[model samples]
Target: MRRLKAESIFTPKGNSVNEKMYVPRSELETAFIKALRKPKHIIVHGESGCGKTWLYKKILAERKIKYEVLNAATVNTAGSISNAIRALTARLTPFETKSYEERKGATASVGVAKGDLQHTRKYDALPLEPYLELIRILYRNAGANDSFLVIENLEHIVKDEKLVRELSSILMYLDDSEYAKYKIRIILVGTTSNLRDYFSKIDSSQTIINRTQEIPEVSVLLSADAKALVKRGFFDLLKAKCLVDPAKGFDEGYLLNAISWFSANVPQYIHELCLELALEIEANNYIITNELYTQCLRNWVQEALVSENTRMEAHLNSKATKHARRNQVIFTIGLISSNEFSAQEVEDSLRNRFPDSTYGKTLNIPAILNELASGNSPLIRKTPKGTRFRFLDPKIKIMARWILVKDEGKDTITVKKFDESIKF
Candidate 1:
């Protein structure tokens, strides 16, 4: 059997849109493609690591549909967007001679595209019309049908009301009859699922929301997809076999479950974990073992968890009392099966993981949960109902599993033998 390099299969932080190990999500693909077929703009939003950027880039490239990507974080205003495009296309204005023809003539050709070529001295103030028309003229002049302006990392600007409102107006303006023929569209990509809510507080939001097609939240991979990714990476591409059973009866196998469980089935996390595992594999034997998996956890933590571990220490071993048991509770909570969990879930987890628990009997689960969420550096926050809580950051959950601390002495704590914890 032919084999390929691990870098090609596992590209967590690179531009590997057409990786052989990619597991397709048909529903998302259908919705996005349909939006591309129509005149409406597109909004693709989900959790931070849910692959929002990758999803659109992959689809756009596959169909030979051209797209220009701009980060909302950098271009936070309407003027900045216009400026960024000017820089991106290497100043689309004419090279020399009469510049107005290249600017206005190019605009006139593209469905009544408008721009104020007049000098600032000619008007009381420089016209804002040019800011909006630059993109229209640039895309129109490029002459690619079915093109896209993908504005990504919108989370950077979601909190600023003025920026959100500015973006809303821009979206509405693009839906004008003047630009109907170009068939160009906007694909807004962001991490927050409630991106539309940020837009709603502005004026005429209903019209703004209606113009953009909402694809279903790009979410974590399902069980089958998660398993497929691991199998293809380890078995199909690398031709490396594992020492453990594939664990095929249920949703995931032993190897896939271990990788998916800690990564929370996030595509980027899965890629990172598998990539590290691939690097650690012995070339001569080509056999993956439990000890290798353990080593990979340490390797991954070193690479990705410096900040997460520091956050864990902020609330760990709360000095109020040694019997507080806050650290253990946090670790147990990391093993949670869902995003939102109750005090009962933590108690249940403690019972399962450490049935011979002296602490479980006298534990005030809810009280401890409250403590973690209420401090100078709170790690979690309660929902509206106040009965359940979740980590303020999702990465905290993964850190829960592999919390590494050199000191387990009188005043400190950490998870030792994390490889064995998977079995328990």
Candidate 2:
């Protein structure tokens, strides 16, 4: 049998897994594929690391669909949207065939820069006429071709009313104009809860909202899927040279279980943890045991804590009292066995942990919980039980524990291990 390669097994962070390694997401993939076959616009919204972008790219490429990606992260005004549409037109249509002068003239009226067509100047109002004409021309030539325009990082401009209105107009045009006959789907990708939030502030968003076919939020993988992911990366994909000899008493079972537990079925976390373990194995001459995996996990957790602490201190500019109070809540929450906890439970824990502190004496547990659960980058989420809340990602829980341990000056933190019986 051919030996596997390490890189093939472990995908680096922020990179998409290839089709061979791509795990089908069952119902979600089915629904998304079915939607792709129709004419309605698509909104693929989910948690940040839930593989929304990867899944979309993989499916589109595997199906051999023609699509153009417009990153909305840089889009803050109407002109940027126009430029994005123009750029998409240039790629999908025969507009590039026109002479440089003709292309300049074609874009000049739309506020696009003559010297650099890709860079557009801000417009006081959306130049709808040029975009309509361009879309009409493109669709006319498409001739049964299935193409899509994907706007990624759309959450970036959701708060900008002008951009939101312009986007609504664009969607409305696509849905209402003669171009709708071509059945070109406009895919909006983001980490927002729903597309409705993008147009919530706009009065004319009803038309766009009515035209949308939303894909439900992408979620973490099931245990079986996550196990298969790990198994494929380790036993199947890790090169023979990277594995321990049969004589070595490495406990593969324990390591795999630990990975699945630590990752909490999040694909990105799984890849990251597995890659770190693989590097450790390679460096240590393929000698891996339960003890080594535990040590590795501890080190990884500490490293993550340092990084997260620096980020929070720099970016989260809260008053000293509020900052300390939030940190206390986070650390207290970490000590609990379950991810989900009640405001009362958290309050009690805080009081027990820091009895003399102001946070323990007069903290508004409910308010703090709400803020943490609903903030821009939410660390926790309100559960269906009303007052109960759970960490949005398992990694946050892990980091909180690390923070707790370091603050307490502990030599080691004892993490409650996941049940080992669960397998792929």
Candidate 3:
């Protein structure tokens, strides 16, 4: 085995993290493991970058179960679905390795091909029947052993009624077929709510939903778990040797908590923040102080804010001006509020910012807040403690600050200066 590099240990923007730095959440992992024991269709849905794929892949590998992954995002048409199935079927076939002399002899005889040796690659699109047959063959080859088929990013094609109905029909058939006998398990991973929307076009959607085991929404890591992850990445995996003086109010525990808190207990954000800090430390001759960490974190927040603003701008259309303004309301609320704030407080703040003439008189503050809290990429969410709401991620606050500064003027305080003024 090869040694791991410190630089590669923490992947901020990458989808998959190194296994050594993986922090397992017992609740989610246990639920997934239980689902894997039997032949049940599993729907794993969660926010993006919440480690749904990582957890599934890790558990499947640990269990030593044979599995094939198909990306549903690319399977938009019947032919594409058939191609995906064909690829999975190919994985079940065994390949034989020949000795060097035998390989050389075969290569030398390639020019003198017999009638039986002549072969042509098939280009004709396969119909639904052949696709179903291929699925049956795949399950049949599994024999007594159990296998997993993970369909990832299903939300991409969930809106196509034709594709959705066909996929549901196929899954329903394989699930109830006597030939399968529960030997092959199917897992659909997406960001959608339930299979409700995907299977809405099909009549047998009820049966499909009943047969499937839907896992609870994958949530961000707990504060304790997030801290442990930081420790593992910094001390164990990367073996970070940066030392900060105790007089400067920096230590392992404080640093861990700071990272966890600022990241809003999200695993991906934690990695991102830590990765930036690590790079800064390495560049500074392996010395890190509380001030350095804060500076790096502020820089990370500014970069994230710019990226998010750009994304929103790219997504906005000519008619989305009002929508953009409403988003600014949500962003402003997130920026000033601490962890949690009441709806009344948010409304009051909005009114104060955009007085009666502009938005105060007409804006339905509560409705806008509710919509923001409930949307697909929710920036604010209601807390368990009564009617108060808070930003789902700390990074949202930074974005909100960026919006505020941009709206004011170029002469307004920059993100770095603003972050410094605030005592995080």
List, residue by residue over 22-124, the lDDT tens digit for candidate 2: 7788778888898897767898977566688788888888887766677886565435687767666666665344422212223344555554334434434
TM-score preference between candidates 2 and 3, better one: 2
Please give each candidate's TM-score.
0.73, 0.68, 0.66
> Global CA lDDT of candidate 3, please?
0.65
- For candidate 1, which ten residues in a row score worst on lDDT? 98-107
The candidate with the higher lDDT, 1 or 2, is 1
| Cα lDDT listed for each candidate | 0.70, 0.65, 0.65
Candidate 3: tens digits of C-alpha lDDT, residues 386-413: 3777665556654554333323522122
Best-fitting candidate, scored by lDDT = 1
- Candidate 2 overall Cα lDDT vs. reference? 0.65
**Candidate with more favorable, higher TM-score: 1 or 2:** 1
Q: Indicate the residue-level lDDT of 275 in model 3.
A: 82
| Candidate 1: tens digits of C-alpha lDDT, residues 183-300 | 5677888866556766778888888878877888887788678878888888878888777534432222677777877777778888888889888784646678777876786677
Give the CA lDDT, 0 to 100, for residue 330 in model 3.
54
